[model samples]
Structure formats: structure tokens, C-alpha cells
Target: MRPFLLLLSLAFSGLLAAAEVTLTNGEWPPYLGQQLPHYGVASRIVAEAFALEGVEVHWEFYPWARALQMAERGQRVGTAVWTHSPEREQRFFISEPVVESAYHFFHRKDRAFDWQRLDDLRGLRICGTLGYNYGEPFQQAERDKRLQVRRLPSDELCFRQLLAGRIDVFPMDKVVGFAMLHEHFSAADRAQLSVHPRALRSDPLHLLLSREVPGNAELMVRFNHGLAQLRDSGKVAQYLLDAQQPLSLAP
Candidate 1:
């Protein structure tokens, strides 16, 4: 009878242990957005991975900088889909890659742009998003005043300036750039934009679990296990495909 009571207690505690994790997020389309289906692919992936472990995620959306600040301050469980950085790794338990992004230069087709290195962009009018890191070399070039850059508040603005001939080139994620062009611009405008065959940078984005919050390290580990399982099941690739080509793909 005592063993049976012990089993009941354990089952009850197990049910009680089924908990929800709150995560901070921001707008990064086709990857994460408040309006997109499943809050975009990356957020969906995070939610599903946690679901596999019988955990639920409650998402909180904020400005990108504020999202990072809130998560790092342990106001939430973590932030999703951030590119790996050494400074971040020092403060958070970085999960295995949630997604990877390849950034390329977007230019008008008539402009015929090409570049082997930063020096090649010396004379062109470059546009960049404020608070974005294009990579170390690009940052160094900008810091040294070797490249002239006009900073904009968002990618849409940068692309608008590019289309208006006010900006010669903008660096953006390839999949995201194409998605934005298709969704926001006309077919005519889409024809005018071209991506450089070479990528500026390729980085894997991860879940940043705050070290300031005790037990989050274990949570990161559990999330990683579920993430690995999701990857192996081939759903991540399919989800990405759907996000990238929403028009033609049947989800």
C-alpha cells in the first residue's frame, strides 16, 4: 500500500513538474515575427522542441535590443535565434544552432556589382541597418572610415533606399532578402534586385539561456536534446523550406 501511495505521489509531482518556459523574441521575418504563422519558423522550431519534452513556451516580443537585455537580465528564460558571439557565450548557455543565415549584398541588377574584398566597395554608396554587425572585417572597415555607410532603422528602409537609387548596396540575409522582396515588393522591383553570389557571412543562430538564472544551464541541455531530435527527424529543414518558399510549398 505504501509503494502504491508512493507511485501516486510521484505521478502527481510529475504532472506538477510539467512547466512553461518564457522566452523573449523580436521581429526577424520568415525566421521570427509576431504576425507570421507559428511566429515564423525559428519560433515554431523552439516551441516544438520544447513540446517534445512536454514543456510549453510563452513568448514575449520586444524590440531586439530590449529582448536581449530582458533575457540576459534573467527576466525571461531566454531569447531565440541570435547569431553566436563570444561576448554572448560568456553570459549565456548557448544552445546548439537553431538556424543558420547566409548574408549577401543586395544591389540593383543594372549596377553590376561585384566584390572580392572590402576594398572593392570603397566608392559605392553602402547602406546598413543600425545596430547590426555585418562581420568583423566590415565593422573594422566602417570603424576605420574606409567605407561610407548610411544607417537605416530597418531592412525595409534600406531596401527602399536601394530601390530609390539613394543607396548602392545593402547587406542582408539571402533567404530573408528574397522573402522580403517577394512579400513586400512588386514583381518588377524583385526583378531589379540581385544577390551577390558570394556571401558576406554565414552564422548559426542559437537559443541564449541566461547564466544569471540558476538551473537554466540544465534547461539548455534538455532543450538541446530535443532540438537534436527535431533536427534528426528532418522537420527543421522542411520548416525552413516552407518559410523560404511559402508561395509554392504546401505545408
Candidate 2:
């Protein structure tokens, strides 16, 4: 009787555990947005991947920094749509690559500049989002004073500064930059901005589970397995296509 009761209790606990998994996120549109269908591309892929594993997901949106903090502290299971960094690797178990993004420089059409190498940015006033990791070379250049960087609160602000001629160039994800341009600027204003032909860097984004979370290692395994299945099934590509269609229709 005692053994039977223990087994029943274990089964009930397992059922409760399988009911849901929570993830933290921020408003990074076309990739992850609260108002977006399925909460945008990456979010859709993540949801489908977990669904394949018979797990339900609950997403909590917060400021990017706060979201990362919640995941790092294990206030939630993990944070999605994050780029892997050495520091993040130390604090979290990163899942398989969910998506890749190209980081490119954008400048006013009349202020076109060529970038063959990092050295070309010297003496330029560059704008970037606060708390973002552009890339190793970019960071090193900043530390070595190769260029002057001004950090702003959002991509919209960066573009606003560019239009006002307060900054020379800003680096942003290619897709995100275009989306922001459409969302924040009129047709005439958008026509004045152009992304550099050369990309500064390309990075893969992943879901990062905090080391502080119990059973996180197992969760990572499950997520990767499901993500692999989704990719193998061609669902990943479809999700991206769907995300782009809406943006293409944007005014």
C-alpha cells in the first residue's frame, strides 16, 4: 500500500510538471513581439518545438535587461531570442541555434560611407542600442577608441538621431532595422535611410536557461531535441516566411 501510494504521488507530480514551461522575452518585433501572431517568428518556432514535446509554454514579456535577469536568477525557466556570449554561457545553458541575424550599419542616404574594415569607422559617430553586444571586434574597437559610440534606449531613437544628423551611423539587425524604419518613419523619411552593403557580423540567437534552474540540463536536452525535429520538418523556414510576409505588407 505504501509503495503504491508513493508511485501515485510521483505520477501526479509528473503530470503537474508537464503542464507548462515559462519563458521570458522582450519586445523585439519580427522576432518576438507580444502583439505579433504567435508572438512573432522565433516565438512561433519555440512554441511549435515545445508542442512537439507535449509541453505548453507561457511567455512573460519585460524589459530586455529585466528579462535576462529573471532567467539568470531562475525566476523563470529561460529567456528566448538571445545571442550567445561568453559571459552568458557561464551563467546559462544555451540551446541550439534558433535563428541567425545579420548586423549591418545604416546611414542616411545622403551620408553614405564605405566600410571595408573596422578601421574605416575611425572618427565616426556611431549609435547603438544600450546593453546590446554588437560583436567582439566592435567592442574591441570601442575600447581602443577606434570610433565614438553613443548608446540610446531603442532602435527608434537611433534612427531619430540619425535623421536629426546627431549621429553618423548605427548598427542594427538587418530585418529589425527595416521593420523599425517602416514602423517609425514616413515613406519619405524611410527613403533617406540605407543599410550598408557589408554586414558587421552575423550571430545565431538561442534560448538560454539559467544554471540556477533545477533540472535545467534536462530541459535543455528536451528543447534541443524538439527544435531539431522542427527544423528537420521544414517548419522553421515556414515560420520565418510568415514573419516576413506581415512586415512586407507594413506601410
Candidate 3:
């Protein structure tokens, strides 16, 4: 083979290799789920973003904790739709924000409460998802014993406990909480529940690439560029709107 032809073939192979990426995520409805259309909104946005760069994505769904572990160990290129944290920032190369989620406290309609600060949570038994990161303030309060928290395996169980008065309240993403209510409860049951009007916090979710992965920094750059293109083209906004459509809700 001619020397120039050999070089050209190797370059083509490298391009093909760089065009594929594998990612992991858990079932978080309206954001990501295997049964969802386009695998939910954030999934679609990530897909489109990579498509802009001629890259293809292969996604695997696992338990949230397991997925994060796999990504951290470099078993997958990255995981998507993760809330930012100082620990994650130190351990991974995080892409630009992919979605914003409003966290709110939910309780039975008959037991409504309001709070302007974390202090109000004192003496309350709050339910939390076992592997979720609900921001630093909430974690700190739990760690410092300022509030009592019961970690549950799933959101459905937490909602059941809340209704049965076993838990005072539970925090969840506004959309995700509503979707879970609609999925697991009767119309009457749903009507008996309410989310606090005040959001605890609004945090941007990002794709976190494991620092253990080779060339992860370059991959982050590619992802950010593609994400920026998606935003500038108005596709990200459209994806957000579509994600909230009733038809997209999980069963």
C-alpha cells in the first residue's frame, strides 16, 4: 500500500472510533426512561447534541447508584442528567447544563406546611431517595442531625409513607413528583397530595464523564460544543416543552 493511503485509512478508522459513545442513566421520568419517547427529554437533547457532531450514543439504564458507580469506574463513557456537586466536580469532567430541575417538598394536602429556610425542617421526619443528592444544604442538615431523614429505595414507597403519615414530607423534583403521583395513585389520592409552592432549590443537571476515562477532557469539549449548538438552534427549549407534555409521562 502507498504510504499516503495507509495514513488516510488510519485517520478514517480514528474518526469512526471517535463517533461512538456509550452512556448510562437510571429511570428518572420526564428526564430519562427506557419506555419514554426518545427515552425522555434529556435523553433526546443529548442524542441531538451528539448527532450535531456526527456522534452516536448508546445508552444503558441501571439503578442510579449502580450507573454512577459504573461511570466512575470507567465502565461507560459517562452518565447523564446528574445534579452538580463538589464531589462530582472533583471526580469527573462535567458538561454544560442539560436541564434544570426544581426541588420541592411534597406532603398530604391536609398537612400543608411552608418554610423559608432549612431551619424549618427541624424535628420533621423527611423521606429521601437512597442514592440521590438533594444539594449540599439538605445533605448537611441530614449529616448534622438538624433534621431526621428516612432513606427509601424508591419514590413510590416514599409517597406511600407520606400518605400513611409515616413520613412528614418528601423532597422531589416538581415534575418527577407529580409524574410519580399520577402514575402510582388514584385520581382521588393525587388530589389529596400537594407540592409546596416554594421550591427548595433549582439546580442544573449535567452529563458527568469519568476522569478515569482516557481522553475524557476532549470528549467533554465535544459534548459542550454540541450542546451549545443544540441550545442556539432552539432545540433544547423545544425538548423541554415536549418533555412536559402529558403524553410523555411515565405509566
| Candidate 2 wrong stretches, greater than 4 Å | 1-17, 245-251
Candidate 3: list runs displaced more than 4 Å: 1-18, 247-251
At residue 134, candidate 2 shows an lDDT of 87
User: What is candidate 1's lDDT per residue for 103-159, written digit by digit as tens?
Assistant: 999998888899998999998899999998999999999999999988998899999
Which digits, one per residue and each the tens of the lDDT, describe model 3 over residues 130-164? 87777789999999989899999988999899989
For candidate 2, the TM-score is 0.88
What's the lDDT of the predicted structure labeled candidate 1? Answer: 0.89
lDDT value, candidate 2, whole model? 0.87
| Steric clash pairs (candidate 3) | none
Distance from true location, Cα of 244 in model 2, Å: 2.4
Question: Local error of candidate 3 at 126, Å?
Answer: 2.3
Question: Lowest-lDDT window of 10 residues in candidate 3?
Answer: 242-251
Give the lDDT of residue 3 in candidate 1: 100
Q: Give each model a TM-score.
A: 0.92, 0.88, 0.85
Ranking by TM-score: 1, 2, 3
